[model samples]
Structures are given as structure tokens and as C-alpha cells.
Target chain A: MTVHALKRFDNVTELAPQALVPADTSRGLSITAQGLEKSFGDNRVLRGLDFHVPAGQFVAIVGRSGCGKSTLLRLLLNLDQASGGQFWFGERNDAKPDKSAVRVMFQEPRLLPWASVLSNVEVGLGDKRGTPEGRALALDALRNVGLETRRDDWPAVLSGGQKQRVALARALVSNPRVLAFDEPLGALDALTRISMQKLLGQVWVDQGFTAIMVTHDVAEAVTLADRVLIIEEGEIAMDLSVDLPRPRERGSVEVAQLEGRILRELFRNSKAGEDA
Target chain B: MSAPAEKFSNLTQWILPIGILVVWQVLSSIGFIPGRVLPAPTDVILAGWKVLLNGELAKNIWVSFWRALVGFAIGGGIGFALGLANGLSRRSERFLDSTLQMIRNVPHLALIPLVILWFGIDETAKIFLVALGVFFPIYINTQHGIRTVDAQLVEMGQTYGMTRGALFWRVYLPGALPSIFVGLRYALGIMWLTLIVAETIAASSGIGYMAMQAREFLLVDIVVLSILIYALLGKLADSTARLLERLCLGWHPAFQKR
Candidate 1:
């Protein structure tokens, strides 16, 4: 089937708009990319990539700098145009997915510094921002992130970790089907990063949305993700299933083995490129 | 902070200005300063009283005040509109920026002779000059603010389903506010500066005209009064801007300073 140069999963969903998306068995949505491609001039960032992320699955993508991990997330998040091929969500792909059901949590809190914490969370509701229900939902999301008391405070006053938590609430307030995180904790200190990792994991468990996180930290990738996909030269070099229990001890034997495996693949590719 | 501490801090601000006033008054009264060339502070006060009795002082103040405000609205209104347009849309910038930049390079006050020739010694000339003086600061700062709104924030807003209009309201406008306020304060300073020049050069009314008139009669007290009035008005405008900044940018650390 012929596809447009830029496509967002605008097709009709097999299930109803509000039905379970890969979380409840009766209804499910999936992100399917078939030989998806992207390039900027002579530089090919993603070359014929393919993957299917089923509903409620937490997938972490890690790669060296410029490995197109971010590029893949951008394409999925509808932030950039794909050079060729197609990717879409839901059981059938024709029209794009519900726009409100997709969101991206950037590395920066991107919280409107001018807005209060609750108002920032309400930003995720889009048109519903002015509604009372939207306000209540935002407050609830803030509570889930343990920031209900700071709802009235400006985002500037909150510590860095707290700000990221507000950002997380903003992502979750809409009950989105797909949450794409672009290294949301990349700027955080080590201890703060660990706490944020826990919050991110708990959010996924409770929300049940499909999550795609791009990170440089292999340990974080192994700890939080159900599946870890390592990209090299714009292709998935390894797709390793974590197959571990929730709250998996960080740096445990199982986690370390998976981390090492993914790192070796990435390192081997970089060394090969250097030689060439 | 406690109320006394707050009051003490407030008093600290007045110390230098009050001290200067007291010293100047003592010097003038003691004959260390000549009354003709430089009037005593008391004489300046008496001149203010004389103007108050005749009510010309109010009329002149009103004229100058009105001129500044009207000019600000016209030049600044257009500037703000263009700034947002040019800042948000590259095509608009491409179409209009070079021309505006060329116009901006010409010092606005330098257009005085041409402005007077075009509009005569009327209110139009003064207001036009004032408007021209105030436009560039607002335009340049507002455009800079909008252009520099974090691209990441804009992208996040888009993914969250903000419409084009929503993006401006929720992201671009708030993001650009700090810089816009910077422009507003600067424009206010220029508004007074421009009005002073225009009124002093050619006007039958306004504080500047009164000052120019006093020079002929050597009523140095009224001249000093006019200069003092300009300082007070400038301070008033600045405080108002600061108050607004505090209200809007309470989230900012700089604005929240005690």
C-alpha cells in the first residue's frame, strides 16, 4: 500500500476510541512500523527499521549518540516527518490515531514556567483545560506523583526531581495510549534519577499505556523496560526481553547480564565504525 | 519579613535622595549657592505652589502625560503587533524585517527637524516623535522574546494537542512575557525622553514648555520643578512596570526578590 511522506496513525482503531489498549484483553492497540525509514539529506538516520510495540508494553530504546534512537521516537511522537515507509497505531492503520491519546515527555520538564504545577499538568488535557473535570484530573495526576501540596507553586520553585514528576503527571493526565519519553531523566543527578526511575515504572504499572523510552543508561533501560531494543547504524542491533519481575533490583545479576549484552552490541558496532 | 524590617528596608532607599535634598537646601539658604542660577529647594517648592495656585502646572502635566501615553499606544501597539507577527512567522520576518531594521538604524530622535517641518509646532509633531522614539525597543525585545521560546516546549505543546492558537496562548505568549516587560519598561523611559525633547523644542503647553519658558525669565525654581517632575514621573512609570512584573512573573526568581 502506498503511504504519504508524513504519516501519524490516523487510521480507525479496531476497538472503540476509549477501549482497552493492549492492557485489557478485550481491546488493544499496537504501534507497528514496517520498514520505516527516515533521512536528513545525505545522512540516513533510520534505515528500513521495523518493530511492533503491543499495548501496555514498556519498551526502552538505547543507542550511542546519533544512532537514531531519538529519531525513531520523534517519528513515532509525530515531531518529525519520516522519509519513507509507514508506522501506525491500533488494530487497523489508515487514519492517524487519536491525537490526544499520544504524548511525549521531553528531557526538559517543558513545564510552562509561568504556570503553576497543577496548571502545567492541565496543559496535557489540551482543549479540556478550562473545564472543572480537567482541573480535577490534573490534581489527581499531581497526587499520583506525590506533588499535590505543591500544585499552587510555580514550577521554578520545585526541585529538579519534583519538576520532572510534574512533567510525568502532565504526560499521564490524559490517560494516553502511547507515551514516548525522550530521555526525561537525562539531566537529573544520580540519586534523583533513581527515584525518577521508580516513579516512571509505577506510572506505567498503574496507567497501562504503551511506553517507549529512549535513554543512554543501559541499567535504566533494563530496569524499567519489558523489552530493550538497542539500535546501531539506524537498525535494531538487538531486541532483548527483560523477563524480570517488577521492582527488579537494580544492578542485580539478571539486570547486569542484560545490560552487558546490550552494551557489548553497541560497543562492538562503534569500534567497527571507527576502524572503517 | 517582619513589618519593621520591611519598613526599615524601605527607609534605606530614601536616605541618599533625602540627604542630597537636605544638603542642597542648606547650601542654597546659606548663600553658598546663588538663587538666580540654582534655586533653593524651598524656592522650588514655592514655585510649585505658585503654579498650583494658577493651575497651569496641572494643565501642562496633563498635556505632557497625554502626549506620552497616546504616542506610546500608537507606536508601541503597532510595534507589538509586528513583533509577534515577525517573530512567529519566518515569512513575515523575511518580508518585513529588513525594512524595519533599516528604519530602526536611524535614531528616532534625529527625525525631529523633519517631523517639525511636516507637522508644524503642533501636538502631532510631539506625539509622532514620541511614538517613533518608543517603537523600536518594544518591537526588538518582543520579537526576541517570541523567537527564543524554547523549541522543546513548543514541540511538547504540539504533541499534547495544542491548536496553533492554543500554542501561542499557552506557550509562546507566556514564554515571551519576560522580554516583553523588558521592552515595556525601556519604552516608558524613552516615552518621557522623547516628550521632553519634542515639548522643549516646540510646544505652547506641557511641563517641558514651562521649563523652556522659565529659562527666558530666569525663574530657575520652575525649571528645577519641571526637572524634578520628570524624575518623579519616570520613577512612577518604572514602579508600575515593576509592580506588573511582580504580578505576572511571580514565578521568576528575579521578580520575587524581597
Candidate 2:
């Protein structure tokens, strides 16, 4: 069943460039993982998993808490090493992780309270980038997030949504090939979440980085991701594609149907767990 | 109206001190309190004026000020370096923290007798005492601050591809600074206390030495003046530290009101 789902996903990726809107294919790195396993002592978080994300694709992984979705995200970002299996970025599959090619926005903004919003974004550009050029790039990112006016403000002064926008800017300032988000908008209010969803979709389209997001909000997954993956028991139980057009309506029938299917899969597992 | 309200508040601040001064002056004039036990405020002021005119007050104050400043710098520098070393590396902490913790328990004042015996009532003994007294607060607080820095922010820095040194400068050091300032304010208090004790025990100069010399001759007024000088100096040091905290940690929530 998993292989069948993966084959369908491959078909979608092959059809994506021609069938749907043509995404910017020049800037993203393809991700490939085979039999990726992670264990903490006796407790195995991720049993074994295989997945692939094409360059410039926006994919969302949704699952119940403790299904190792976050653990998988961490492994992808090289924050934790896999116990076994091969993960590749582009063509390189060596043990040495390519940290500079990827950046992440956590559930919280994680902005250094001591730094101004501009300086926080500048941190994304490591020392190799010259100071003046880095500052210009950081400012450009802030402008993209529509927070150029707040460049001098401290993170403490920002609203929850604004802080997340700063986090987004910081993630994008370095022009990373892959952007990983671990529930980046989970803390915002409903209205703010909608607006941020629009902003994230727009930015991902503009920058065209291979975007992977792990979230529990099924509706969010359906609305934003071009591909929705439902992970169950450390495995991809469902790999479905959202073929809807960009700027999707929130309460549209197509979006609601996809959300319902994803939620049913998530709840079915939780119900089974309770019965056990 | 707001200006008057502000003026009223300022007046309220001074009311108690002025009232105490009046009571002291009246008691001294009426002979209700003996002057020998505690000299009158006027007598202290007059003694202070005399010392000031003769340059004794300036010289002694300068000596004590320089001693505290130099001692604090040495002790604070060492404490900050050690804190960074142990905070960043588990190996350094394992090798050094236990021995330092054991030594921290010993009250620095208890070493005065040995210090004097070793250095014999010289500048070395006095400065050593002050440095030893100031060291522990900064060291312990700095280590505590570094350890307590938010782990999520550190992880964020790592994911951004910061080198270890860059992470320390950009994240760990800034995160620990507020706590370091707290240590600094506490250490300033100890700096003055240790200097007073050290100068009293064995010194030819400084405010404590002058006060001791006045006591030998029963010059109660000069002794009272010296006490007032110590109080003023302590207040000055505390205010200076608070000003620095305001300047450096303006982003801190507590300091943001200004």
C-alpha cells in the first residue's frame, strides 16, 4: 500500500511542472531518504521510513503527536543523526551533513531577545557573507515578510504573528535550498494564522525552495501543501497530493474534502491506539 | 498639574531624611543625647569640611576608590573567563567545578588572618582580600546564567550554521549578560565591605584607616564623617552599576520601561 502511494506521488511530481503552475525549478535541492531509523535507547521513535521530495515542492507531514513526525523533521535538518539509513541532499550521500543548505523555523520564533529584528535575520547569513551585503539581504527578506517597518524593534515588542514573520525572514535570508518548518504558525490566533498561511504560500512560491512542514492541523496541510503526507507509527501511511490551484479558498469544497480525508486517517489511528 | 505632581513626589522622597536631620540637631542642642556616643550631624559636617579643606578626605577616598576598582576588575575578569570555559565545555566543568565549589564555601573574610600573615599588612594583602571577596558572586552567577540560557535558542543558532565561537558571542554571551550584571551589582557591595575590613585590619591609608586613627584619638566627628563617606561611596557604586545595566540591557523586559 505504501509503495502504491509513493508511486502515485511520483506521478504527481512528474505531472506537477506541466499540469499545474510551473514552479521555479532552478533553486531547490531534492531530498531522498531510504530506511531512515532513529532510536533513543530501547525506545525506537522512527522504525524505518523512505520518502522523497522533489526540488521546489511544498510538502506537509501531518500525524498525531508522538508519531515521530517532528523526529523526522529534526533528522532532515541534521539536528539529530539517524541510527540507520541513508539520507541524501541533491546527489551527496556522505556522512557529513550539509548544514548550510537547509534552514528551519521552529514552533516558537526563537529570535534572540538581545538582538533587533534586523540583526536576528542577519544571523542567517554566516560570517562568509560580507556585513553590508548581509545587511542588505536581511533587509530584503524583512521587506518580503512586510516587516521592514519593524526592523529596529526588539522581538519582545512584536506580536506573536509578527515574531513568526521575523522567523520566516531569518530562515529565508540566507537563501537556503531547503526550508523546514516545525509547526511554525501553531501559536498564532485564527485570523493571524490565515494571513500567515497566505504569506507562507506566497513566499514559498516566490523563493521556490523545497519546503517541508510538519503540522498536526490537517486543514492547514490541505490548504498550503502541494502534497499532504500522513505519517502513522513512524511510517508514511498516506501520501496524497493536493491538486487544487494556488491561493486556494479556505471553505471551498475541494479543500474541505482533502481535510476530511486527512483527519479521518489521523483519528482512525488514535481510536485504534485507545482501543489497544 | 503634572509638573506639580512630579515636584510633590520628589519632595516626599526628601521629607524623611530632612525630618531625621532636624531631630538629630535638636537632640544634640538640647543635650538629651550624649555627643560622645554619636556625634551631632553638624559636628560631622564640620569635620568633613575640615578634612576636605586639608585634602585628607580626597586622598583617602581616591585610595579606596582605586583599590576597589582594580580589585573588582581582576576578580570579575577571572570569574567571567572561568564561567565561559566551564559553561561551554563539560570536560572543563567536570575537572574544575568540584574543586571551585568546595573553595566557594569558605568565607573569604576568614582568610584575612592568613592573608595578613602571608603579606604582612601590605597593599598586596588588602587587594587580595578584596578580590577574593568579590570573586565568588560573579563566578557563581555567571555560570548559573550561562547554564540557564534557553536551550531552544541555542539549537536555533546551531541550525543556522553558526560556529561554536560565533554561537557563544551571539547567543550564549548575550543571554547570560543580564545575570552577569546581577552578579556585578552584588559583587560591588562585597567590594566595599571587604575593602573596609581589610583596611581596618592592616592599612596606613584609605577611609577605614583614617576612621581607625580618629577612634584612637577619640575624634568621634571624624569617625562619623568616615562612616558617611562609606555610605556615599556604596551608593555611588550601586548607581553606576544600575546605569550600566540600563545601557547594556535595554532590550530586557524589566529595563524596557525607560
Candidate 3:
């Protein structure tokens, strides 16, 4: 069911991971955490959290505000150090993983206002920047986001949705093995959010990167993830696999049922906390 | 906003200055206003022409302009470098920023007496005063600019594997540019103010020195001519700064006219 978008993703030869993924194999990397923990002074954000995400799987972390879902995403991306416990990537678990294999799209577009759309995308190329191949890769990334024509324009001119698309392009340019998002569409309006979700889903299917997103929206969680993980009290409260067909309708019975299950799990814990 | 309205506004801006000149000329012609009190526009223009012919005006203007520029370069340069250092490193800020802030609180002009005593009213004392005068605004603004750069963007840069150098060039510098330009514009104004005071109090030759000599002789026309030159120079410096801001910060929405 989730495989429908795979066909459309194959036509783009330039970004289809040339020899990087060994042709037929997935470029995605699996992530495994063993008793992960983090705390900010007295506030324990991630308390003994444990989960394993397989290669190329789409995982959505859903929870209420202050549930440490965003904190978990940050730890995965190494934006913050874990106070306790160990986590490592698949093959890289045995060796020192290059940090380049992980990338993130923030809730804000975070596009460099001073850089042009193309140059902003090129910034993702890291050391490869300022080279012709890097330029071509950046242009390809822009094309991926349907912003190829706006390569020369400053980021300030683009709309919020368009800016996020450029940011997505920048994240995808380096072909990360694991991509995490921290409520990447939380700021968008309803219509733009829907479109962005669709774009994100399509990109994940095409890129075959291990996709993980932290969001509060239950419907968004069901509509996107292969597996939905609800976080509560700095722990994974519920782990449910979504088996619905491709392009799951937002208001459909099955999707709504899944969303309802996750929502109940989330509210139940919050209710319990309030009672105690 | 329309073409004709913009044109009218432009026209209105020049009308008052020109009108004042005309009214003053008329009053002076009728001898209602004496040349000793305030010279007529014609008298001032003639005085300006005489100085231009003898090259005194050019030499004085050059000296003042050079001093202002040299001071700006030295002060603004140190401000930029130190601000960048303090902004990028907390240790540096802890060590240097307090001392700098303490120095900033003292009025730079108040040091003129001490400066004259130390450098004997030579070019060094004058340049030091101007340099000190312009330093604080640029330093404060530059530090504020770098410090306030969105933390989210810095995090994003780090996750994307941007090296420290890459992050500085691609994110920190560009993000801080608008604020830096604000500093530059503010510093330019102080540059002229400090130069004028420094030159007036002492020195060999400049517009300020010329004005002092004119005052001693009671040459009101020459004094008025010196004032005009100072105004013109100030406007020229401001315009140059604005042009640079426009060029460097074209990406800023405030600067995008088109």
C-alpha cells in the first residue's frame, strides 16, 4: 500500500542514489537506542527511552507538548548529548558513523535569508560546496522541491510553504541515511500543511531514507508513518504499526480509528498525570 | 506611491532650502540683514569661489575628509574584530566585554582634554578622539547582531555538517549583516561629529580650522561657507554608507525596492 509512490520516485535519476546505496538496496540506516536518557537540570526529558527503527521505515513520534518527543529527535540528530544510554546506527553501529548520514528539517523553514534558494540548498553539501558537482546536486535538489526556477532569488521573497520546500531540498541534497523532522509542518496553515505532508511522504518513499518525525497532530501521524510511537513521561507509551493502504485519506475510517487509538493513549496519560 | 506623487514629494523637499536662500538674498540686497551678522547667499558663494581659486578650501576639505576616514577605519575595524571575537566565544566575552562596556559608558569626547595632553593636539590626538568616538556604536551593534542570530539556524547548520568556518560565512556573517550595517551608518555620523570638534579645538588645517580662522577675523561669509562644506561632506558620507548597505543587504526585505 505504501509502495505506490515508489514508482514516481524512480524516474528522477539524478537524486536516486547512484552507487551510494548499491543500486537495489535501501540507502536508509536503522537506528537502535539502548536505555537512552536525557535531562535538563531537574527536568528529565527522555527517561530510559528504548526503541529500534529498521532501515527505510517511516516512524512518527506523536505526543502532547512537553512529552520529550522533540527532545528524542534532537538526541537522534546529535543536536544534544544524551546524559545516559547508548544509541547507534545499523552498519555504523559497528563503526564510527559519519554524521552526514543524518539530516533534519525543523518546524521553521530556517532558510538562510541572505542566500539564494540554490545557494541555500548547496549549503547542505558541506565540504562539497563551491564545486561544479555540488552546484549540479543543489540544482537537482531544487528541482526535487519544484523550486528550480527560483534558484537565483533570495529566500525572503519566497512564501512560507515555498521556503519549507527549499529547506526540504537542502535536507535531501546530501542523501542522508536517517532523516528526522521536528513538527516540520506545525506552523503551516491547513491547506499548506496537507500539501507539505504529501510532499514529505513522497520524498520519503522516493529517497528510501529512514524517516522519523515528531508531531503533535494525531491525524498527521496516522497519515504518514509506517509505525506510530506515542511518547509520554519521557518514554514510548504505545507503538502501533499502520497497515493501511497508500495515500490514506485523512478522514477515512481506518486512518481515523488509528488516530483515535493514538489520541486516547496520549490523553489517558495526561489525565492520569493530572489525577495524581 | 504613484509616479507623480513621488515626483511632487521630491520637488517639495528641495523647495524650502532654495526658498530660504532666496529670501536671505533678498533681505541682504535690501540691507535689512547685515553681511556681518549673516552673509547673503551670493556673498557666501563668492567667498566659496575665492577659497576654491586659492585651493585653501580644497586642502582643508581634503584634510578633514582624510582624518574622518582614517579614524573610521581604525575604530570601525577594531570594533568589528573585537565584536566578532566576543560574540563567537563566551570566554572572550567574559574576559573583554565588561571592560569594553565600562569604557563605552564614558563619553568619548570627555577624553579630549586627556587626549590633547597625551598627543599635544597633533594629528594623533585628533585621530584618537574621532576613532574613540565612533567605536562604541559599531562595537555594540556588531556584538548584538552576532549574538541575536537565530539559534535555530545555528543548530540547523550544525546538523547539516557545516564546519565552523562554513557556519560563520554561510550563517553567522550574513545573518548579522543587517545589524552591522546599522552600526556602520550610526558610526559614520559620529565620525564627522568627532572630527569637527577635534579640528575646531586645535590643528593645522581643516574645514573646522578654517571656520576658527574666519571667526577670529569676523569673516561671517567664510564661516558660513565652512558650515556649508561640512553639511555637504556629512551628506556625502551618509549617502556612501547607504549605498553600501543597499549593495550588501539587497536580500533584506527593507532594502528591496523592486
**Which ranges in model 3 have alpha carbons more than 4 Å from their true place?**
A1-25, A272-276, B1-13
lDDT for each residue of candidate 3 in B1-258, tens digit (9 for 90 to 100): 789988998799689878988999999999999888998999999999999999999999999998998888899999999888888899999999999999998989898889888998778987898889888888888888999999989988888888899889988998889899899989999998998888888887899999999999999999999888888888888889889989999999999866
> Model 2 over residues A49-105: C-alpha lDDT tens digits?
888899888899998888899999999887899999978877567645356668899
Candidate 3: the clashing residue pairs are none
Model 3's chain B yields a TM-score of 0.93
DockQ for every model comes to 0.82, 0.75, 0.85
lDDT of 2 at A106: 95
- Which is better, 1 or 2, measured by DockQ? 1
Q: Quote each prediction's TM-score.
A: 0.93, 0.92, 0.93
Candidate 2 CAPRI-style tier: medium
* lDDT (Cα) of model 3: 0.85
lDDT tens readout by residue for model 2, B13-126? 679878998999899989987899888899999999999999999999999998998888888888888887888788999999999989889989999989988999877888
Better of 1 and 2 by TM-score: 1
Candidate 2: regions farther than 4 A off? A1-22, A92-99, A128-130, A272-276, B1-19
